[model samples]
Target: MAQTNNATLIRREIITRLCRLFAEGRLEDIDRIALAMAPRNAQTNGSRCCIHKARAIIKYRIMALLGFNVADETDELESLYSYALRALAGTDRGEGVLTVVGEACTSCVKSNYVVSNLCRGCLASNCMVSCPKNAIVMENGQAKIDSLKCVGCGLCKEACPYHAIIYVPIPCEESCPVKAISQNSEGIEQIDYTKCIHCGRCMMACPFGAIMYKSHLISILHQMMKADKPVVAMLAPAVCGQFRASYGQLVTALGKLGFADIFEVAQGAELTARHEAEELGHVLATGQQFMATSCCPAWVELTEKHLTQLKPFVSETWTPMRYTAGLVRDKYPDAVVVFIGPCVAKQAEALKYPGVDYVMTFEELGSLMIARGIDLQVFEVEEQGAVIPERQFAASSGVLNSVAAYYSGEQIKPLVISGLHKKNMAVLRRLATGKHDWNMIEVMACEGGCLSGPGGVSSPDVARKLFNAQSGVHTEMLVQ
Candidate 1:
């Protein structure tokens, strides 16, 4: 009873903060102030300290109301708040995300035991005959199991051929690509966090909904409300496909949130197209045959981990996300910048730059709307900026194809690399050995770029195809 009372109190506090930030229109301000308060860290270069603290206070209030155990709840709440702040600022990253993934992965198994009732007095003992490890035996005309001798191997199931054996897959074990999941003696699944890549595949695979993410919308809303500074939003192109609402309406909605202006990361891509053209000219002048794009953070991380050699080949230009923030800072030096997108990787990118102050995902943005009692459908529609025909580059090889379109006289060929793991490894090798030639290259981490990131709201392939088609048809209409 006491615990229930406490839980209610904490939940109320969280909701209350949400309301205050929205009502006061200070979400962005709070973010800037919190960031200003965070002491510079020699290691991370002083990111989001004030925002982190504000989030902690909220989480503590919630834990208290929820009747969470003081000791365990305190530790978990600290980590959750930290993650929440990171999400708001957009620098929440690999190791931390992996820890959440690990805990969630461990919570999915219903049970570990499977029995075969096919045992018969037949002397042939087919089940025993098929046991490679000799784990099964016959006793009292029935099979008595010796689990110690069993390896949980499904061979006995296969041998029974009678179809009496069952398989109970552990969630973590099923989702792991590196095969790093295993069971403890008590049947709980354990994840090797060190081997986990924070891909978030396990979180999607868990049927029990144990894997969860800390939402940072409340703190971010507070920061936005409190700051007196100019605030501009950089919207990722993948966002074009995320909501049921039209792209133009979403921009108008964000405008209502107090962002002074909205710029497409695709516009930054237009700049990237121009920049890559210049870089290609330099590569040609220098007789350097290989150069890679540096747009995708996940691909970048993968390259750092498994293809260190390819770092040299990556383009020195800032990614569209970073460059867009740079453009905002250059134009509005007093602006508190935020990146609103579909990626957790973008969160890490925001922390690395001085210009971008926060990273909020689509989901967190939705949370902010809910916290504020703002129904997106009810917002008055405002005129959207013209849908630029050249902006599709924000989507897929949209970058590479756009670059190709810019060159009229010269028949310059360019290479395109897509997908996170494969392209990074390939580009790393090309850069290291200087083996490939192309005037320019485009690389998106997911199979179809941002459309397929782990943080996406729909099926990756379906989302990518949909956006690509939408952009294609939109461009075609303009051309006609």
Candidate 2:
């Protein structure tokens, strides 16, 4: 519950309800049962104006969970039961990784600046004088913002001595690093997939829970329930610190959830570390500029879509998830490899790699555990004999450390790009212009690396400590 956000809780409830219906073989009755249980009564209103409207929103959420495109106009008039039947029939998968529940979007004001009641109408007129765009004006003894002239530079807010000026950012727009989210003509938020990196930051930032991602939970569950072949669970390094239970217990729980085998993605990270280190060494030896790590799918996408100049310099190494899935495929040719991690971008990344059969976030996996009634605390820990990779790979500088450890004899001049913010773009621009001095660069789109991933279970602070402790346990082994 510590990691549970309002959005995460809502998603969990929807998934849990779907799983219950699936277990009871009552998927046909999902719409009626979910609506009844969601609002409980006419008095049980949620974020919407009434319980009925709230239930309507929930219906779309259930549709997204079933892999249906919530934004598809063709299904605009369809019922939730219809979508459920399609999902059960295994025919309709969503067209995109992200979608907006237009009904849930509150249509907040588009302006980023607002004149607050705290404006004292001071005679000094510091706010007025500081406005580079002359966006601030005084009327009726109160400060006002001229939306037409306001460029959102925030100079007026900074200059106001009374701190009366307030910056009211649209959460989704502000959180999106690439400015992919914008308001449609109807005032509903729409994502431009061309610019979107599938990072899920906008989804996490929206307070109204308006944004959501298409889930493959039902598809994965169907495969799990069938049990025709092996289903391998590939856990990311961030998994070490996700839950209250120990890692061993979590592995045992996966088995109980019908996974035929478990593999640590950290093993793949170890392989990536060596591969990246060697690649970096070769690049440096050949007198090429610095090489950026390509482990983060979002960062890779950001370069491909926006920073086209930097794409060629990005390391060609596969991410740990993909590399691990490849190994899983080599061993079990017909196995379903599910990559479980904190990354939402991996959902999109999985689509590009045939080795990966499915991708589920830590939040989604938590819901699956709840729906299956698998209590991690009570599960007996199974002895896992696999080689656990360096846990530092879960945090920002971990990749640098991993690659440095791999090339211990060389002096690896490293640059770390902790997050994809507006300021960090300047660095990438500099790198593109051949202005940087480093031999290797580590870039993670999410601040503090994968532990701060949008789909992460624990907060970055807590996850960092847990990941550090785990890293220390096998430090010597990792170096070897």
Q: What is the number of backbone collisions in each predicted candidate, taken in the order shown?
A: 37, 0
What TM-score does candidate 2 reach?
Answer: 0.88
**Whole-model alpha-carbon lDDT for candidate 1:** 0.55
Residues 1-480, candidate 2, lDDT per residue (tens digit)?
124566677777778878777777777787775566554656643566877677778887887887876788474668777776677578857567888988889877756889899999999989899998888889999999887688888888898898888888798998888989988867789988889998888887898888888888887888887889888999988877677666788888888888999988888888899998888888877888778898999999999999999998999988888889888888899998999998888988998777898888787778778888988879765554554555567778788888887774357677888778778877888888886577788899887888888777787777766765543332221210
lDDT of 1 by residue, 1-480 (tens): 001133223333344554455476554343232233233442322221444543443443332212222223324524434434444454423333322322223343343335556656466666677767777667778554466677776676676655655677666566554444566565545445445444444544555323333333444555666677767888877776655555676777788777788877777777777777667567656866556677776556545655666666677767777778778878898887778876765655665567777676665555455555666566555555466544565455666666555544334556666553433444545655655455556666555556665555556655655565544323211110
Q: In model 2, which regions exceed 4 Å deviation?
A: 1-3, 40-46, 88-92, 118-165, 382-387, 408-410, 469-480
Q: Report the number of the highest-lDDT candidate.
A: 2
Q: Cα lDDT of all candidates, in order? A: 0.55, 0.80
What value does the lDDT take at residue 230 in candidate 2? 89
Return the clash pairs for model 2, or none. none
